[model samples]
Each structure stands twice: as C-alpha cells, then as structure tokens.
Target: MMQVKSVTRIFGQKAALDDVSFAVEKPGFVGIIGRSGAGKSTFLRVMNRMTDATSGSLMFDDRDVLALEGGAKRAWQSQCAMIFQQFNLVPRLDVVSNVLHGTLNRRSTLASMFGFWPDDDVLKAFAILERLDIAEQAAKRAEALSGGQQQRVAIARALMQDPKVILADEPIASLDPMNAQVVMDSLRRIHDEDGRMVIANLHTLDTARRYCDRVIGMRDGRIVFDGTPDQLTTGVARDIYGADASFNEGATSTAIETLGTEGDDAYAQSMMA
Candidate 1:
C-alpha cells in the first residue's frame, strides 16, 4: 500500500502540486488525466523521487518514502520503476544491453561502464524480452527498432528491476493508434501477470476508460475527480478539464475499436510454455 499525504510541490513561487493526497491500498491500473501543465507529470516525478516535494509524506507500507536518501533512495527507485514518454535507451547499444542497464544500481559503476553484466542477468533480460515478444530483436541496436518496439524494450528494461509499481509518464502519446494499443496491452499484461501497480499519465479520456481500473482527474494542480472509470461522467470530466458546457468527450478520444485476436490469454499461455 502507498499513501501520499498533503503533498505539495513548489516551483519557485508557484505550487505545481497543491495538497495532493491519495492512497493506493491495492495493485491495479490507475490513470491520471489532465490537460497540459495540470501537474500530472510533476506528481509522477515526486512519487519516483526524481523531484522532491516542498512538503508532504509518501509512505509505502512501513517505509517512509520521502526521507530515503543515497542507497535507500536508489533501492526505492529500483523497486518503483518509471517509464518515460521517450524510450530512454542508449541508442547505440543493443536491445538486451539496454535492458541490462536496469541492474546498474545493484552493481559497481566500473562494471556497468565496462558492460560486464552477469550471465544470470543476461539470461533474465532475454526472458523478459521473450515475455514481451521482442526476444528476436535482442541483438538489434535500440535505435533500429520502431517507436512501438522501442517502447516495448523500455518496458522490458523496467521489468528487469522487478518493481512493485510502474509509473508511466504519457507512455503512448507519441505512437500511432495500433502501436498505442500494443503498448497499452503490454502494460496491462505486466500489471495483470506480475501483480504490479501501474500508474500512467494518459492524454485521452477513452484510453483511460478503456485501460485504467480507476481514473484520477487533475486540474490546476488539484485532483478534481477520483473514481472508477464508470463514475467519470461527462460533467465530472468537464470539471476536471475546465471545459465549457459544450465539451464533448469523444473529441479527445484516441481509442481503437479492436485489438488483434492474439489476446492476453494466448500470450500468457505462450509464456508458460
């Protein structure tokens, strides 16, 4: 369980997050939706400890997440993986090597600098790539893969951390509709199969409703709505986005109507074999 209480982040004089408070008592897919500069990304950064909050406490179970520093902080980061909008792989490195970078914190800097990963780590990286259906691209350079495949490599890297929670900041904003579906499906599969909490900053209402178990709507650094997808009514969405009475939800929807028949079950079966 994670608890964020009275979390407020300041940027110079302005508050990027104002008294933000929420608790995740269980593992599930959560979507944070808001317009630009609405503090969605800032909130994720704070959770990941990439940015410090001016005042607040973040507690994960018995651990005091806010006070962790040095090795403790690094451990927290390894436990709570983050996936960015851009695939943050070393472009020149092979896909498997990029995935192995997830273990950098656990190894000495000198070893990582020399690219001397352990045999077990190498095998685990390959297994993760296979689970994500990208094992064939292991030897390919990270930059050689398409945008969607690059994102899958990013996901594989995150899984190498064996994280308890995955924080995704606008994960699908750059991809086409089919690619977006693939990325979202992979994230969902990770959450379901691994029982990890996946919190994503999503741009589209339809995507949130389709992929997220719960939706958190933010506006002007404050949460305006928090509930299940079904509870996110048109009126509530208008309030969250600060839209006029004429606001239409479909205008912001990028949801694909159908995905390929090779569904989650089939993928799980293949992994089992």
Candidate 2:
C-alpha cells in the first residue's frame, strides 16, 4: 500500500502541489486526469522521488519513502519505476539493450557502462519484450519502431526493474488514436497480468474511462474529484475541465475494440505455443 499524507511541493514562491493526500491500497490501473499544469506530473515526480516534496510523508508498504537516503533511496527508485511521455529510449541502441538499462541499479556501474549484461539479464529482457509482444524487435534500434512500439519498449525497460508501482507521466499524450489504444492496452495488460500498480497521468476523459479502474481529477494543484470511471460523469468532467470545456473522444470506441482484438490474438498465440 502507498500512503501520501499532506504532501506539498513548493517551487520558489509557488506551491506546485498543495497538501495533496491519497492512498493506493490495491493493485490496479489508476489515472490522474487534469488539464496542463494541474500538478499531475509534479505529483508523480514526488511519488517517485524525482522531485522532493517540500513537506509531508510518503509511505510505501513498510518504508518511509520520503526518508530514504543514499543507496536506499536509489533502491526505492528502482522499486517505484517511472515511464515518461518521451519514451526515453536511446535511439541508437537496440531495444533489448535499452531494456537491460533497467537493471543498472542492481548491476556493476563499470560493467553496465560498458554494456556487458549477463546472460540471465539478457534473457530477462527478452522475456519482458515477449510479454509486451515486441520481442521480434529486440535487435532493432529503438528509433526504428513506431511511436506506440517505442512506448512499449519503454514499458519493457520499466518491467525489468520488477517495480511495485509504475508511474506513467502522460504516456500517450503524443501518440495517434490507434497508437494510443495500443499503448493503453499494453498498460492494462501489465496491470491485469502482473498485478502491479499502474498509475498514469491521462490527458483525456475517454482514455481514462476506457483504461483506468479509478480516476483522480485535479484542478490547479488540488484534487477536485476521486472516484471510479463510471462516477466520472459529464458534469464532473465539466467541473474538472471547466464549464466551457469541450471533451472529445480522444480514442474512439472502434479503435480500442480493434486493439482489444489484437490483444486477444496475441493471447491465443501464446496459448497455442
């Protein structure tokens, strides 16, 4: 379980996160929904310790996440992996090599810097790529794949950490509709299959409804609403986006359904094999 108590982050004179408090007691897909500068990214950064909270407590399971230091802090970071909007892959590196980078915290610094991964670590990378249905692209350059595939490769890298929580910061913000569906489907599969906590900063109401088990609505550095997808009604969306908001279907139902079918096909192939 992750417990955040009265967490506030201040930048210079402004408070980016204002006394935010929440708890995640179960493993599922969680969506943080808000407009630009609603503090969604800041909140995720604080959770992962990418940015320090000015004040408050962050407890993950038995450890005080906010109090961790030195090597312990580095280990904590590995346990709570982050996925970025940019995919963050080395464009020149092969996909498998990129995924192997996830094990850096556990490997020898000199060996990792030289790209000398052990056989077992290489196998683990292959397993993660297979799980993501991108194993065939293992030897390809990270930049050679499509946007959605690159995101999946990024996810594979995160999984190599064997993280307890995956914080995705606006993961599909730059993808096309079909690619967005594919990425969301991959995230859903990870949560459903691995039972890992997946918290994503989502940009659209439709995407949240389609992918997340819970939606957290934020406005101006404060949480405005927290509920299940069904509870996120049009009225509540207006409250989150504003009265003059025009919410469009970011990913059409047809696109998501098609992606679902593709996932089913992959599952069937795995079963057959």
Candidate 3:
C-alpha cells in the first residue's frame, strides 16, 4: 500500500500540491485528471521522489518514502518507476539497449557506464519487449519507430525495472488518437496481467473512463473527486474542470478525431522524408 499524508509542495508562495492525502491499497489502474496547473504532474513527481514535498509524509508499504536518503532513496525511486510524456528513450540507441537502461540501478556504476549488460538482463529486456508486442523492433533504433511504438518501448523499459508502482506523466499527450489508444491499451494490459500499480496523469476524460479502474479529479491543487469512473458524472466533471470548461464528451470526441487525422498526416510526411 502507498500512503500520502497531508503532502504539500510549495514553490515559493505558491502551493503546487496543497494538503493532499490519499492511499492506494491495492494494485489497479488509476487516472489522475485535472486542468493544466492543477498539480497533477507535481503530485506524480513527488510520489516518485523526482520532487520533494515541502511538508507531510509519504509511505510505501511501511517504508518512509519521504525520509529515504542516498542508496535507500535510489532504491525507492527504482521501485516507483516513472514514464514520461516525451518517451524518454535514447534516440540513437537500439530499443533493447534503451530498455536495458532500467537495470542500471541494480548494477555497478562501472558496468552500467561501460554498457556491460549481463546476459540475463538482455534476455529479460527481450521478454519485456515481447510482452509489450514490440519484440520485432528490439534491434531497431529507438527513433525509427512510430510514436506509439516508441511509447511501448518506453513501457518495456519501465517493466525492466520490475517496479512496484508505475507513474506515467501524460504518457499519451503527444500521440494521435490511434496511437493514444495503443499506448493506453499497453498500460491497461500491464496493470491487468502483471498486477502492478499504475498511476497516470491523463488529459482526456474519455481515455480515463475507458482504461482506468479508478479516477481522481483535482482542481486548484486539491482533490475534488475520487471514485470509480461511473461515479464521475457530467456534473462532477463540471466541478472538476470548472463550469466554463469544455471537457465534455462531444468536445473530447472532436479533439480525438482531429488528433487522429493530424497523426496520419505527420506519419505520411515522415514516410516521404
């Protein structure tokens, strides 16, 4: 179980995360939704130890996450792996090599720096790529794959960490609707098959509704709602996104269709290039 207690992250006078408290008692897919600057990304970062909370406590299965230092902190970070919007792969490296980077925490610094991956680690990377349905692309350059494929490779990398929790910060924010669906499917599959805790900061309510087992709504750095997807009614969405917000189903569908068309255009352009 992961527990967050009165966690507040203050940036100067601004409180990015204000008195936030929550607990994840079991493994499931969780979606964190909010408008920009609602502290969605900040909260994920604090959980992964990418950023510190100015006050309060974070505990993961009895370990004091906020109090960890040095190697203990590094271990905690590895256990709570993060996936980013940018797909954070080594553009020039092969996909398998990029996935292998996840094992750096468990290996000697000299071995990792020298690119000396053990045979078992290499085999594990292959298995992960296969599980993510990207085994054929394992030897290809990371930059050569489509956006969705790259994100799958990124997921493979995260799995190589054998993490207890996976935190994805807007993993599909840059992709087209088709690719977005693929990436979201991959995340859902991981959560279902592996039973690892998956928490994602998502922009689209539709995607959250489609994939997440639980939805958490935030507004003005505070949690506005927390419940199952069915519990997030249109009225509750209005409260989360504000009365003037345009994040309804109709608007979301239009945006997704537009993004899908744009992604097709970009793919065609890349092929011509």
The TM-score leader among the candidates is 1
Which residue runs does candidate 3 get wrong by more than 4 Å?
A: 245-273
Better of 2 and 3 by lDDT: 3
State the lDDT of candidate 1 residue by residue for 64-97, as single tens digits. Answer: 7888999999999999899988988999999999
lDDT of 2 by residue, 106-188 (tens): 98989988999999999999999998889999999999999999999999999999999999998988799999898899889
**Ranking under TM-score, best-scoring first?**
1, 3, 2
Worst 10 residues of 3 by lDDT: 257-266
- The count of residue-pair clashes in candidate 3 stands at 0
Q: Where does model 1 exceed 4 Å of error?
A: 246-273
Question: How do the predictions measure up, each by TM-score?
Answer: 0.90, 0.88, 0.89
Please write out the lDDT profile of model 3 over residues 68-187, one tens digit for every residue.
889999999899999988899999999999999998888898988788998999999999999888899998999999999999998999999999999998899899999999899989
Q: Which candidate leads the pack in lDDT?
A: 1
Runs in model 2 deviating more than 4 A are 243-273
Model 1 worst lDDT window (10 residues): 256-265
Compared with the true structure, all predictions reach lDDT values of 0.84, 0.83, 0.84
Root-mean-square deviation per candidate: 9.5, 10.0, 7.1
